[model samples]
Target: MTHPAAPARRRFLISALSACAVGGLTTSLTACATSTFPFIPDYYTFSQKQVQEAVQRKFPYQRTVSQVFEVALMHPVVGLLPDTNRVSVRLDARLASPFLQQPVNGVFTLSSQLEYDPQSRSVVLRAPNVENVSVDGDAQAYTQQINAAAAVLATQLLTNYPVYTFKPDQLQFAGVTYEPGTITVLTNGIRVQIVEK
Candidate 1:
């Protein structure tokens, strides 16, 4: 009968040989060794010009969104300012109410930081700040009262808004997946670094 310990000895020898081969890595041997394992680190840069173009396309001249007390928001101009590390939106808004027969014109400006959410696999806007506000005449008093509320509203509108959302199929390109990192804001654009799983 075959020795019972022989099989165990053989297996141990085989494992030892394999480990030796891997640890001692010959150039030819390593070159032939295949790894289908996917994932690599990479950088994807998106330019400010691209963002501006997209914003223009998305809003294109003027768009009205949300209304309160018969006052409506309109005429938006979006901007990506690297100096501020934020994306800004300037709008020409008019407040109209039963109390006021004429529409009150004012400017509203908001800015938001850009960030990458690895869990969500997208670049999104966060914590919008109402940086500036200007209302002429009597509208100034009314706007002052609602400034906090308006900022909150704007923040809500911008919160979690995707600056760039990647699809799964797109992530598969060259074994690249969503990378977990901070957004680098530059004068021309923002760069996001990605890595393999």
Candidate 2:
């Protein structure tokens, strides 16, 4: 014969198991939802290689000397100042002319302050100072001439090397809009933050 409380006990056990299963599934889904939403970045850092490639690709090579002299401008190695708001530049130039008896190489270093322009939406590096100059052997004949030529190339670099730039219309993505704002110069790179809401 069945016990008097047997059916009630069996029903209670079934209810407990169903409740446990539903609770576990609910917890898993909540975890998934939290993981996918609500994320914001504080800053962005561009690497040395990335900066090099961007500047090299975007910065146009310019000829400092023409009819009378022959010289070609190349990309520069750029670095950020650790404590100061400055950028260090080192440029390499080659004296290429079929008429020349020997090849000559020139290296130049420039230091300049970085500035942000609101109108054009570009970072304009100020006019750079020539920190040092070195040229291949027996350049005394062209020392004065080369210095002038080097200055021209340095100016071009200071004017063209852009840390960051974004047009007003191009800043929107995925329901969020990125408007250009303040900038900070880091030791190895730069940070461009989005405008505050």
Q: Which run of 10 residues does model 2 get worst, by summed lDDT?
A: 28-37
Off by over 4 Å in 2: 1-43, 58-68, 96-101, 167-182, 193-197
Clashing pairs in 1: none
User: lDDT value for candidate 1?
Assistant: 0.64
- Superposed Cα RMSD, model 2: 12.7
- Tell me how candidate 2 scores on lDDT: 0.62
Highest TM-score scorer: 1
Q: Could you give me the TM-score of model 1 versus the true structure?
A: 0.64
Across residues 87-177, which tens digit of lDDT does each residue of candidate 1 receive?
8878666666544557777777888898877667788878888988887666666665547645765765667777776667635555444
